[model samples]
Target: MTETLLILGAGQAGAQAVLSLRQQGFAGRLMLIGGEPFLPYQRPPLSKAFLSGALPRERLLIKPENFYRQADVECILDIPAVSLDTAERRLTLADDRQLPFDQLLLATGGRPRQLQCPGADHPRLHYLRTLGDVERLREHFLPGARLIVIGAGYIGLEVAAVAVKHGLKVQVLEAAPRVLARVTGAEVSDFFARVHAEAGVEIHCDTGVVGIDGGADTARVHTAAGDVMEADVVLAGIGLLPNVELAEAAGVACENGILVDDLARSSVPGILAAGDCSNHPSAIYGRRLRLESVQNAIEQAKTAAATMAGKHRPYTQVPWFWSDQYDLKLQTAGILQGHDRALVRGDPRSRSFAVFYLHENRLLAVDAINRPAEFIAARTLIPAGGRLDPARLTDESVAPQQFA
Candidate 1:
């Protein structure tokens, strides 16, 4: 009997797994299941180009519809896997169909963390997590509309930038003291705050939305400061929660996310997890991390595929991510945890600089603002674990090559 491999979630990780398996000479029965009706597509562009109407719907697809058929990968779209039975090696779909498999990969991804306050269910309140969500929100982006964005993170800031370009009055409310506080340092946060402010985005840092009021035509955001700001549309961009319920229900280990090894293997034999849903140990960072970036998802899927094909390759690529807001591009590499100091090279005022996070002369991470060359060079230096002189790193006269 030919062995059957079942993949859940059909997002970037699931689709990549199918491709990687074929490339690695795994000719077994391949099946991918996704909750969304459409084929696997890119999510990053939904907030920027796609939301701005600059990118068409067809461009969002990762592969043409025929690619799945050509690859001989069976795709079951618009239905979700309701439950998983690791003991029986069976998965129960929403329609009560049980599918058995020799091996399984969970790439369920994540869902947006919704606002819990009262009136959050109002018709005008919006959250962007899927293509459908963005399409619905796009209709409200008329010129001169009032957009009240809740959260100072990438999604909120990106949406604000897009709204500003469309001639909308934007107000961003961040619960934290500064923008991008959770991911970036104070210097980087302040720099982004200035950039967004200069783009006509009203950023209210240290402000929390207590509740929302009103209906379809408008919304009034009640803040922790006893102030109410009305909006034509309100967007909640707090963050995401990993889709690990299936893994947890199957008795698989889960901590914050589905616990997986370097090879994306779960505690249960023949079961693996990847993408935003899995939290795996990082050989570079020496800790368990659940990254939501497309880079992490694709790399982890390849690792899972290789391991399932009996190659046992580990996922050790240095993690990297990027964000676009207005005319600025922010690129980040490596995990910035445990960094004691940061060195800035170039002028933040000019909007072209790189901030290097170091620990006792060792590079840990790099955040480059509109400096792709420096970002690319820092990616290599980080994984190389090479020591650098702080003075030379910060010196504007020195090029990035000198550090090598």
Candidate 2:
């Protein structure tokens, strides 16, 4: 009997799973489903190039449309899977259609965290999560328009940079004491803060937005510090909440995201999850993490597909992420948590440097800004658990190979 595999969510992870399955010689039935109307596309570009109109919508697609037809993969678009019956091996779509499957993969990525404050429902208030979001926000990127951006994370900072390029006055409100506080170290955060400031982005750190008020034409952002900032458009890039309701409803263990093992297998047998929606143990970092990067999505999907194809393979890829703001390219590899020391290689003043985070003598992570060579070296060194000398790392004359 030919077994059928039904994949939920047609984002990067889901699309990669289909390709991986075929590559692994899984000739059984394959069906990829997504809530979005379009074919699986890249979401990272939506905030920058796509928003700035530098890249068209067609370029965001992961594969050509006919690739699905040629691969014999059925694509169900513009519809969402509302319920999952793990016991019965079935799924119910939003349109009340129930489909049976021999195996299931949940890649229902994530949704943008919406502002709960008043006036958040205003038409001018935007959250850039989908292609449609960028399209709507692009309409408001006129010259001299006021853009109040809440949060200073990658998404917020990227959007602010793009808005400034379009001649929009961008003001970033961050609740943390510094920009990129949650991800990067203090040195890297300060560097980015200075970079954005020099780029004409007014950053207000530790400023909590109490509420947003006003109507369609304009909005007033009220801060906890008794300040009201008016804006033509309000953009909130707080974070993302992983889509785990379907997994949770089907009795799958979830904590922040669907709990999966290194193989991307959930607690329930015959079911798996990946991408931003799955929390899995990282053999590399020795901790469980739910990564929201495309690198993690593709790697996890490949692991899941291999496992489904009767080839057991563990996912142990080192986590890496990148961000594009203004002309600066920030590439980060590995997790920086619990790092006690940080060594800076190169000068931040020149806008080309790498910050290497270490615990004792072991390399933990690296944040490379406009330094691709250093980033590549760190990616190799960190995963290999190479020893490093702090003095050598700080000296620019010392090559990365010396430490390895």
Candidate 3:
């Protein structure tokens, strides 16, 4: 009799894990559990294309029903695992049914960071992280709806783009000195600030939002800077905290995320974790990072699946991410943190193209706007294990691929 390999959470990580497991010839019985009712879907488009009414909702699914059936993977959608027994290697569902597993993969991703200010519980205040959330916001996506978005992060900005396009009076409030402070440089942030401002979207940088003032049909957003912005809807895109409750409860060694080895294995034997809920110490960047990119989900999932199938190879893939807003397509590869010096290229005024970020000499990170070739070339600069000359980088005549 084949023992089951139970995979918790059917998001990108779990869905990719199942596919990778099958590809690696894991003949064990598969059980995939998820809190979401629908099939595994890509979340990036939710705030951009789906919100903008450019892409249909159905197209976001990772796989159709037929794929799961063909792979012999049993899916328990819309159900969350209530608890897990470490000694028995078993899982307890909401209904108290016990599921014995030979091995387990935890892809229980992160949840949206909620605000604690006044009127935070109001019905008009929205946080877009799931498909259902987008559906609800779609109703208010029409023209003339005053939309106030807090946080100038990717989600907030993407949502603002869609709202502004629909003729909504959009106002974005960022406590940071500029937009996207954590991800990119001051140049990128200032560029987006100009673009959004030119689009007639009101942006308040270096401003702190105190609370959301709730009313009968709308809310007044109060900022620490003394600006009271009125809106029909308020969207919060603060950040996410990992859903590591189950792992921590089961006595698994946890840190910023579930402490996992390079193979994506948890501290416990026969247990593994991936996706946004995992933090693995990497040899590439020589640091620990919990990546939230789709690429990480797919590649780390492959690591877990391959490891489960008895392939003991370390996961060593370069991290990459992409974001699309209006006409700008920003692609980035490698982690950019703690870089001493940064080089900026391209003209943000025209919004044409540019690749800018830090590197001691190696290309630690590259933010390419409308430049796919540079994005691809920068990927090699990191792992190539050589310091790229800063002078050659800034020279307009030199191509990024010439780093070779």
lDDT of 1 by residue, 1-404 (tens): 99899999989999899999999999989999999998999999998999999999999998898988988999999999999999999999999989999999999999999999989798999999899999889989999999999999999999999999999999999999999888888889999899889889999998998998876688989999999999999899999999999899889999989999999999999999999999999878888999999999999999999988989889998999999998889999987889999988899999999999998888999999999877888888898987889998888788887776
How much RMSD separates candidate 2 from the native structure?
A: 0.9
Counting clashing residue pairs in each candidate, in order, gives 0, 0, 0
Better of 2 and 3 by TM-score: 2
Q: What lDDT tens digits, residue by residue, belong to model 2 across residues 1-404?
A: 98999989999999999999998999999999999998999999988898888998899999999999999999999999999998899999999989899989999999999888777787778998888888888888999999999999999999999988889999999999999999999999999899889989999999999888887789899998999999999899999999999999889999999999988999999899999999999877788999999999999999999888888889998899999988899999999999999988888999999999999778889999998888888888887886777898888888876766
Candidate 3 lDDT over 1-404, as tens digits, reads 88679999899999999999999899989999998898799999999888888899778999988999999999998878999888899999887778999999999999999988877888889898899999988888879989989999989998888788889999999889899998987767877888888888999888887887767688988888777888898899999899999989999988988989999999999999999999988787999999888998898888999888889767787799988877998888887786777677666766756654555576678888887877888877777757777777777688877755
In model 2, where do residues sit more than 4 Å from their true spots? none
Q: What is the TM-score of each predicted model, taking all chains together?
A: 0.98, 0.99, 0.97
Higher TM-score: candidate 1 or 3? 1
lDDT of 2 at 12: 96
Q: What lDDT is reached at residue 289 by model 3?
A: 91
lDDT for model 3: 0.86
Clashing pairs in 3: none
